[model samples]
Target: MLDAVADLLLEAGYDGLTIDAVAARSGVHRTTVYRRWRDTGGLLADALDAAREVPWEPPDTGSLAGDLTEINRQIVAALTEEPSITAALIAASFRSPAAAAALRSFWEDRYAIAAIVVERVAPGVPARPVLLASCAPVFYELVLLRGPAPGDELAERYARLAAASVSRSGAAP
Candidate 1:
């Protein structure tokens, strides 16, 4: 069902998505979907929550640079490969309160996972900044510049820069 929702979201913007469309695509009855999801926002939130179940173990390459590089690589792949879905989700978050909440929860969960790696590499340092620094440029390029996401070379560079900044601040052991 979540896959169906994702497909529909990519094909049609959030405004085009409807509970009926999701039900039809998912082959589930409208009543069942309604009973479970209640409305489009609830359905989108639940669908995103379900999609988050994909495995995303933090990297353990024995160095902050390597771990951050891996994280950035994943981010680049997600943004470049699924730009439509990514943009749709982001736009929906701005348009709908439920989507905004769901998007926040999704990012919080992702950051929590990234924090495990950051804490391992730099004890006592806040991970959010490091994680954001490592991937924000790629998102900016994709969204604002309307260009391709930064490639692997840029990912590695961003990772090294982030790791260096944190380490130089004496945050690492």
Candidate 2:
């Protein structure tokens, strides 16, 4: 089961994830686990695939800044939460090519759903880069730079900055 996979992966890291451990944890039998998912990467990719189907909707707060700020807050929480699955999966992606691909697919789906927020603000502007501009600092600060979260005010400020950039470039005011 993917639940078992996530738990085991988190407990032991990519090097410790094994069909036997997952089978024991899930009570699914090692043979069944192996037949269904040949290796740790397969299990990781399958978990990401399952996660992609979970229902999600971008924040809709009647303004671009509000929506983007809410999104950044969500990112901060996901990155900092206890037993952080987002952090675990992000780590796994670097160790497994399959996980890397699956993570990419998961984000693509996420961005597509989040695009509606941008579409409501600017009909003709591309949403992907704008969404990146709004969300990148959260990840960069938390993951790469290892800095404390920027918090809500800074999150809102980042949203304001991103919105202003787009607004100046011909998006709706």
Candidate 3:
């Protein structure tokens, strides 16, 4: 049921996703869905959780550059791959308090995962802000400012620059 709702939410945006629609798509009773998840927010939250990426394991390649490059690459791929989901969630967040809360939760988890990798690479520097700032130029300029990078080259460049900055900060080196 959650998967069915998630599919609908991803494809149709939050406004278009209805309990009845999910029930019809999933072949489950509307009453059952309502009973299991009483509200749209709750249903959407569950679906988002189900759709989240599993944690990526950090690698100790003895080089922060390589590890961070891989991490950022993965992040770029994941973000770019889900245009509909991102659009729907962003749109939902603006109008729905529940979706805003869910987005907060989602971002927290996403940052936390990245923080772990940053902590491993640079033990002293703070992870969350630094990492976010490092990638902000790319995501902001691409996603918010310009509209996505030209290709993997731009993402790779961002990763390398981020890794270099962290490495040069005189933390672990």
Candidate 4:
């Protein structure tokens, strides 16, 4: 049922995703779907939670610059390949508290991976802002700024530049 709901959203976006549609597609009775999910927001949130977890692996790489570059590269790739329904879900989050909370839960895993990299790279540096900014450029370029997506080369360049800037501050050696 959850997979059915997620697929509907992915294929048709939020507006087209109706509980009735999910019920019909999944062969479950509409009442059953309603009873379990209550609303579209609840249904989507559970589906998001039930989906596979993104693994976190911090590459030692012997140098902070290399490790950060690799990490950001993988992160960008992951986001690009992420299901389109996720964007719809994110948009829905603005109107629904349940969706918002679910979005936070999904992002928390990514942040945890970012934190580990930051700790290894720049031990004492505050994790949140630095990590946020480090990844922000790629997202800005691709999503908000509507610029070209950063390829591996550019990701590495940005990561290296960040690493150099941070290293000059005597943090990640």
> Root-mean-square deviation of each candidate, in angstroms?
2.0, 1.3, 2.7, 2.6
Q: Of the candidates shown, which would achieve the greatest TM-score relative to the real structure? A: 2
Worst lDDT 10-window in candidate 3: 51-60
* Candidate 4 Cα misplacement greater than 4 A, ranges: 52-55, 82-85
Q: Which stretch of 10 consecutive residues in model 2 shows the poorest summed lDDT?
A: 148-157
Q: Ranking by TM-score, best first?
A: 2, 1, 4, 3
TM-score: model 1 vs. ground truth: 0.87
**TM-score of every prediction relative to native:** 0.87, 0.94, 0.79, 0.81
Please identify model 3 stretches exceeding 4 Å from their true place.
52-55, 59-61, 82-84, 146-148
lDDT for model 2? 0.86
Q: Which pairs of residues collide in model 2?
A: none
Model 4 Cα displacement at 86 (Å)?
Answer: 3.9
User: What number of backbone clashes does candidate 3 have, counting pairs of residues 3 or more apart or in separate chains?
Assistant: 1
lDDT of 3 by residue, 1-173 (tens): 87776678787777777888888999998999899877777777776676566564555566655666666665566556755565567667777677778777877777777677678768978887666755566566555665754656666677677777777888864
> Candidate 2, which segments miss by more than 4 Å at Cα?
none
Model 2 vs. true fold: TM: 0.94
Better of 1 and 3 by TM-score: 1
